[model samples]
Target: MEFPDDLKYSREHEWVLVEGKVATVGISAFAESQLGDVVFVELPGTGDSVTKDEAMGVVESVKAVSDVYSPISGTVLEVNDDLPDNTELVNDDPYGDGWMVKIEMSDPSELEDLMDAEEYQAFIAEAES
Candidate 1:
């Protein structure tokens, strides 16, 4: 239920923290809670080109599997390998250590299209109800 104001969100429940042309991505705290205990994280490789709104990877929780979507078009620059071995980090620190990938956004303007914290929270509320 915690959605930080500084980040952008995808409808798919992914959040992006932009820093210059690079952005860090992770699922929202709401998403992790819904997924239950995360067991496996299928990460995309470095240098992989990703399109906006497309699935970049997947997170498999004890309850179900969920696709991780890219909030911005970019080339994946880094992945948190530790996540695959210790998926609970996602639940423990979704905004920091739980970050799934770092991407060099191909078009920064696309960031303007993503939802802000308030909008995303509203989206979550609507989805839940």
Candidate 2:
């Protein structure tokens, strides 16, 4: 329900924040709500290689477990080291400190395949209805 205008979105419900060669990735607010309270996170370590749209990790919540997908092909530079102990951040600040991974992109142009906030909002609306 809260889609920030500056970020790009994947149809799979991931949000991407890019700065030069690095991309920060996370699930959208809508996704956290859908998943209920998050209980655990399984993430790839730094230096792991992940492809765009691939299941890179998992988030387990009260409602259901879900895969966290990469929005771009990249090697992970960092993971939110705070996440395994602070699952609440995923719901508290999904767009900020709650970010999952920082990736050094293998192809920055792949970002163009994603949707902007406005487009993502419309996409969510249609998916929900």
Identify the leading candidate in terms of lDDT. 2
lDDT by candidate, in order shown: 0.92, 0.94
Off by over 4 Å in 2: none
- Candidate 2 RMSD to the correct structure: 0.7
How high a TM-score does candidate 1 get? 0.97
Tens digit of per-residue lDDT, candidate 2, span 31-110: 99889888898899999999999999999998799999899998999999999999999988889988999999999999
lDDT of 1 by residue, 36-86 (tens): 999999989999999998988999998799999888999999989899999
lDDT of residue 7 for candidate 2: 99
Q: Top model by TM-score, which number? A: 2
